[model samples]
Target: MTITTAPAGVSLRGVGRAFGDHVVLRDIDLDIAPGEVVALLGASGCGKSTLLRMVGGLDTATSGTVRVDGHDVTGIDPRCAVVFQEPRLLPWRTLAGNVALGLPRDLPRNQRDSESRQWLGEVELQGFADHRPRQVSGGMAQRTALARALARKPGVLLLDEPFAALDALTRLRMQDLVEDVQRRSGTTVILVTHDVDEALKLADRVVLLGGAPTGVSVVLDVPGDRPRDHHQPELAALRSELLAGLGVPRRTPLERETHAR
Candidate 1:
């Protein structure tokens, strides 16, 4: 059984961020539908994570407003949960103990165990609940983190490069895990990733952030379905567009020359 929450929609209006003399983002406005998956893609330091943090109430925008479920975010909003790049699990705690930490404080004591077990099972970690963080692989640790977040029954899940630390194969597995869990739970998700194929594989729409001007953003609606084939010919054009926006070449110099001719 999946632990589900009434997924919440996220809204950003005229959002901008700046340090004393430098601006990182400006005039950014976007809306994410409830239970939808959106990926924020760009080169490093493009404010993708910053924008996600704002939505989760982890950071404040210098201008404009951010709302979740139509309520303005003023603090660490309870409606959202985050799974960061690192698993960030406590070394001393057993996997179950760590996941239990995310359970609602008001939940009846009798239901906590079942709740914890259900979420751990969601991430395919039912067999490792008794193990400490020190005993598991990096991918296992990250799966624990994901379970913890989901146990919160968050309306929106914020993912900040959650698979960046895993090996390529492990990363792919985690992506599938996340996609499966999100589909089951029906929570809105905002993923901040630098990987173009990852973005294309999972997102309903991909938003590219940053440019020469910095913080200039573009949104592309990705066709096809979730858990899409990475090499789908339809997505090739979209990949080229995203790479161009990030100022990355999609082909070798010779390939580019050949195409030009």
Candidate 2:
């Protein structure tokens, strides 16, 4: 049987979320097109993750609506899959077994196993399928986590700082892997990340969330071909702009020279 892809668009209107006395997000409005990759960029405690959770139906808004493909989602939407910062794999389960957990219950055990193994291969963890989560390296474990999310063929993939815990090299590798997979699958993705460079490198549009009762402070369109170079002048300029938007101070040339000395 051929697997069908279902990439859904997301819409949020006048959305607000509060925890008791404190409000995290307020009057936020955003729209994401099907197959578009959007990064929610912000500093820590800026409510980017909260906004993403609302889109995924994992959290309810105190005010306004969250829609997926024109339908309002109330609880955990089957159309969405989330990969968090930590791998969060069950230690006792093999990598393939964890991936199989994402498959539909209607699928036969044999088919689930086959599909799980296929997804493992897609994430370059086919050889580790039989290995328990404890047996794999951190990067390998996160790869397995990503495969688990993709195996379900979710219409929308939500990533909450999925690479924040990885080393620099491994993080770059995982970012490349995600770009390749999303390009092939054309799944709509909302990635919540504090890393400005990571957001600019991966997203078609980068939305900055900041300020008290945080909402979008800036929305930048990143127009270019795939596999963007971090050292490119355009990206570097955008990076500086993003950092400034997030209240980061940019050092002057003289200050840089002094610091170097």
lDDT of each: 0.89, 0.89
- In Å, residue 129's CA in model 1 sits off its true spot by 0.8
Question: What tens digits encode model 1's per-residue C-alpha lDDT throughout 52-170?
Answer: 89998999999999999999999898999999999999888889888888898988877887788778998888898889999999999999999999988999999999999899999
Q: Estimate each model's TM-score.
A: 0.94, 0.94
Model 2 deviation from native, Cα RMSD in Å: 2.7
Give lDDT tens digits, candidate 2, residues 91-129. Answer: 989999999888888998789888999989999987988
lDDT of 2: 0.89
- The alpha-carbon deviation from the true structure for residue 90 of candidate 1, after best TM-score superposition, in angstroms, is 1.6
* lDDT comparing candidate 1 with the true structure: 0.89
